[model samples]
Target: MSALPAVIDGRDKRKNPMNIFAQIRELITTTLDTMVQDGTLPDGLNFDPITAEPPRDAAHGDMATNAAMVLAKPAGMKPRDIADALAAKLTSDARITSAEVAGPGFLNLRLAPSVWQAVAKTVLDEGTAFGRGTVGNGLKVNVEYVSANPTGPLHVGHTRGAVFGDALASLLDFAGFDVTREYYINDGGAQVDVLARSVYLRYQEAHGQEVAFPDGTYPGDYLIEVGEALKAKVGDDYLDKGEQYWLEDVRTFATEKMMDLIRSDLKALGVEMDVFYSEKSLYGTGLIEAALKDLKDKGLIYEGVLEPPKGKKPEDWEPREQTLFRSTDHGDDVDRPVMKSDGGWTYFAPDIAYHYDKVQRGFDLLIDVFGADHGGYVKRMKAAVSALSDGKVPLDIKLTQLVKLFKNGEPFKMSKRAGTFVTLRDVVDQVGPDVTRFVMLTRKNDAMLDFDFDKVLEQSRENPVFYVQYAHARVASVLRKAADAGIATDDATLAAADLSLLDHDSELLLLRKLAEWPRLVETAARTNEPHRVAFYLYELAGDFHGLWNKGNEVTSLRFIQEGDPATSQAKIALARATAIVIAAGLGILGVNPAEEMR
Candidate 1:
């Protein structure tokens, strides 16, 4: 007999009722539409400007939207006049208690307390899926990230990009997109040529020859072991046969070893990709020519002379006609070259072809994760995708900034001479993958992260990684305590409890934040920023901590209520929701939610 599938095994499309904020926002939009239909306003109305964002002040209630101000200019009326009419239509909603027209014609929606309570119930009901959003609309997405050069071990800077990209891909997957994580191997560049020469030097040393570092060769000692492995495999066949006999074989062997090191590095960081696309594959397969030809078919590829660069123009400059893509036709600052003067395809050629391949693969959306040094390449890359896809597929590129490592009040410089280059394995071995991944994503991708090796290891409140994990463990501790007291603490029992018994302001605030999970998911997924997930989890943890602190002063606020199993279950329901949301957020960040802190 076949086994029954788990609840999550089946692809069930769960439906959720509109929270008060959503219901009120819908009311405001519908009212504006009705006004247009009645000829009280313009017939064609654009609702993009009407956004129902959470108000900063709690007294203003759940959400606020600018429906009135949006229609004011279009309807040939004052914002206040439009606001009054919109307010009248908005209060008509049963979900919203009062729709007050406030400063600058903004509509402030005051939802009932029951509404916020309902949001908590939604979190409990959906559990980890509570924040799942449908904004992706089942669009296929190809997220290319951590395409680091296969030359050496990954450092802290590479770790940040790896974590960010993995989380971003998971966020898109959870948000209802068919997502594929991809890595583009930079194996066909001059840097790899340098890597080959470096590996050869190491190979000679493996054959017992003394060697000194060259100016352009990779100085890192990683290639030394790779060299030894090659010598063992081929058995001195090319020891004195010169460059022609051994160069290609050594390059291929060295490249594979480097890639193996990189794959191990990514695995240490909990990053796994569905595709590992080789840049060399685009070279001999006529793929680059085809991508360039596709651009030429539309007059985008042409012979052109580039304008002199902004900061420096060589005195020996002579205008050379070369094949360039008309990237300026889209939004690039300048047209870019597809081929160099020597007739070899430039680095950008294979990149354009890779993106073209992605578009051909039926992906509706494309995202690339690059380091901040690639900022100059963003505009041209986006222009290429726009022109190639005919504006059909959208490309969003996220640039991760540098990670500044500090230890003992000094900047930690990883010197290869000291043989102290911190590999991904070194970081994982020191602090484990969960700590490494969490600390890497604690900051915004575009913001510089100060990752102190010492600070991250401290088991204190300042470390957000530990703080958030502690909240989840605290919930588990509460459940254990309740079970010890002979109270039912399972999810089914807790979920079935009457949640209306949870009435404290602190308790309700945590629920309110829990309710925002769905909205936050949609925002993060649409923007392709998973760092927002980490920030949201931190804030949610802050709320949980506040509730825990309140319990110290107010004993009734505790999840365990003496002599009241029903009341205890009700309070535990709120804690369960908190744990579930924390788990969901950690899942997106590729960090495990701790069941108990040890």
Candidate 2:
């Protein structure tokens, strides 16, 4: 069986598609297997990392496999010797045109240019289905993200996690995984109580009573309407009542209102979640207790005093004994408290139950997208999942680094007097979802992103998002022009368009970049990091843009071959293929591809 990464999907969405590159991988591995049978590579060797990656430079080849380098030590030969033998063998294959050894034993394989033309035709034939490569089979996965507290509307920080998670889920779906998008409600915490008090102040104001906003009580006027609505619903039923009489009802009412606001906030940003699990549900019903009991039964829980954390210990640093989980056994620093001294569950309690519920739901994998602020939470959460699932489930927690906002090189400080912060709607409204999503993904999950208000909106080539989108739009415009000029835009015509006419080195390099799409998708999906998709799209767009500019110098390279419909159709097919890949990538990012730039 070929190795496949697991993907998560929900009730909707198609599972991952096994792409052309994966087929190539299987073929290459089969070739190796045959070699082993015929006494070429030694039998006892690990080939897990034997990858077929595109070279950074296209002049190197269409595709380069590390098989030569990997088998060098095992085959007891010099890297070059192994590469030479491998090249000689691969050159015999029908798909390979030329195989040459480069560098210190790197085997570069150049396929027939017909191979690239066929790729374009394949993409046209498949449409959106072209790049749906499955490194991930239908394994159940839960992607938890943007579980921002329902205290207010989502801020700019939540926007990054929201876009990252939504795009990631889309990418995984295309890569063939059963995925569930979940949001864990934080309504069970002290934050919710604060929300209630804030709403009460609003309710009192609605009753024509003067109210002063207190510290820690949410001062965002967002909850004022919720408070007014509450007053209209209950008619001061709990008016002047103590906390015992109204706290629960207010919290329930306020949280529902907050969640409604949050849902609308997500809708404004084009994000949707499959499930919204309430952290409050984990308490009182013995769910958190049951999760803890399960761990305790497995000897992973106990009562103990934890040493103060490495940094400054709390001023209240009495190491009073508390109920602790033996997280160290599962790879955590010391033990972690499941319950506080006051007989209340720690914040980690429901989190454990939440993950346990996910594992219990039969998901094969779990992914959590958290902000960089929660970087310290990674190990403990991993430890909990490890202990709860008994190692059956693998959890990958991605920490989205901070997004620094800048307006023309000045740090864009969020206006404190304006409100709690900027919402996802602000960014989407200003830049549109495509730019917002693409810009957020330009950096890796762990690296900080500088979101410049002015720069991303600039239509220059330096702005990666616009540059990529422009390439797609430019290609689309050329295709439209070709059709208007009576050029056949059908796949069959383009497929037979004397692709042999594409002999220029510039055209060949573009074709090679096109070939890398399938491989790039499979790799990005395998790593479960959609940022790779963003990078690949930028690079592909870069190649396309360079080729487009080349047309100014080389008249024949222009996509619109004047007076020749067939040749124009052939040239336009490459442009169409470029748009198709960009659209595919934008689809994964949950961003819409423009047919033309407006």
Candidate 3:
């Protein structure tokens, strides 16, 4: 492939220069503009639908664009006519070695080898910042995830939400958003009362009194220490007290202790929240009232009777006049009740107030990472945010599906320490934080994931975490080998090497993959899908491994050339660029890039 001119006239200055796809797309758009200016195409033709991406088949070309197909009708010209004209204009640019119109107006373009070579140099120059984007434009986003009730240690389901939320927050931050990692402590409900009662039983056990855990109480051994600590703090002062005498105080103390356990569980999984807002804080604080007032002022709140839930039997259903929010007006399926006829707030009332608090805090966007069981809650939460924010701010709710764990080809049993379910600590302790985090994100948040313990730990390509990490480790090995051979292997030395020597197709293929990093970051960030980052890394690792395997047959494709320092440096530059991108992707996924495989 031949190199095009480094400077193309009318290129969009806003596009990232290092993103090969963006650069080429800019060139195409600018060329289209020229077409319009020269009266070759209609002036009012819209170019928004035009896209330049890699072709589905690698044999086709380096990049493909649908400019001709998308603009043909609007330009009042045949697709081939526009394709022919566009191809001629695109080839005129020196960077494009060839532009072929294929399959009825699709334009396939190939860039010079130097364009791919420059991608390596850019990656070395930018390091971890190579794929960072400015698309967020510094918008404030609050990501509330793992807001599990502070009643016990987080379970496997909460584990998925924690990892997904943390990685998504990191991805958004990498994409230039001012992100706040938050957890809402669910402490303002009857669950805390249950927690208090559970701890009271354990407290009696600590006082050398045998107590039975009731069906509604937590039966986990993880709460034993909390009870012992409570005994140490209050002695026997409340040993024989009535429920009302110690219920509120014990509830507050137990919730804090469980929150501490939750925090430790999160830390074990490498998640740390920027904020931990409390649900109890909204009660008796006028915050809930203020939020409802905001909706009422907008004429969204009224006392009305809701239809009995459709699936409920007549005897089980009761229609009552209650204070309700006109949620349907804001896209919810039905108006939601804010308060009962007896003047008690419903569960959703506090949630609405919580999000209203987020909206009032000046966030440009809000994201809630909830377990899949909360799927039914999505629409109402969105409606609340839409109504509360007056449609100025957008809310994106991501529901993480269940993670079914298996050990030795059998379903993993519940943790003995947690009593009824597997806790986050159990998962992290068994596989380690890095493995836990990476494996949790292997699937989309909304899809069910089967986390086979034996499979995930296997050192095989089927294990994506190991596969990606091994690629990074392989690059590290190459750097070590280059160093032992007395070759200059630092990024600056390799970047300044004679990169023109990297003319092999395998090397160029790796470079092409590196060039997609920035584009991938932007696309994944725009869609709020951090799992896409994990997917891209796996694909990138496969490409790197393919090139590595090719080196075994074709000696010239090896990352190091014996006695040829210049060629070795050029090839090493490619390897180092691959590592840089893998590390950057892992950073976004909250996984540490392994320097050497164990």
Span of ten consecutive residues with least summed lDDT in model 3: 1-10
RMSD of each predicted structure: 5.8, 3.7, 4.6
**Candidate 3 structure quality by residue, lDDT tens digits, 1-598:** 1011112112232456667888888899999999899989988877767889999998889999999999988777899999999999999898999999999889999989998899899999999999888777778889999999998889898999999999999998988789999999989999999999999988989999989976788888878998899999999987988999889999999999989889999998889999999999999999999999999999999999988778756885777899989999988998998897789999999999999999999998889999999999999998999899888778888999989889888986675345558878778888988888999988999999998878888999999999999999999999999899999999999889889998988788888888889888877877788999999999999999999999899998999899999999999999999999999999988899999998
The 10-residue segment of model 1 with minimum total lDDT is 1-10
Runs of candidate 2 with Cα error greater than 4 angstroms are: 1-49, 415-420, 491-497
Indicate which candidate wins on TM-score: 3
Error of 1 at 489 (Å): 1.9
- What C-alpha lDDT do the candidate models reach, one value each? 0.83, 0.81, 0.89
What is the alpha-carbon lDDT for the whole of candidate 1?
Answer: 0.83
lDDT of 2: 0.81
Q: After superposition, how far is residue 492 of candidate 2 from its true place, in Å?
A: 5.4
Between candidates 2 and 3, the one scoring higher on TM-score is 3
**Residue by residue across 330-369, what tens digits does model 1's lDDT show?**
9998999989998998999999999999999998888899
TM-score of 2: 0.93
Which window of ten consecutive residues has the lowest lDDT sum in model 2?
Answer: 5-14
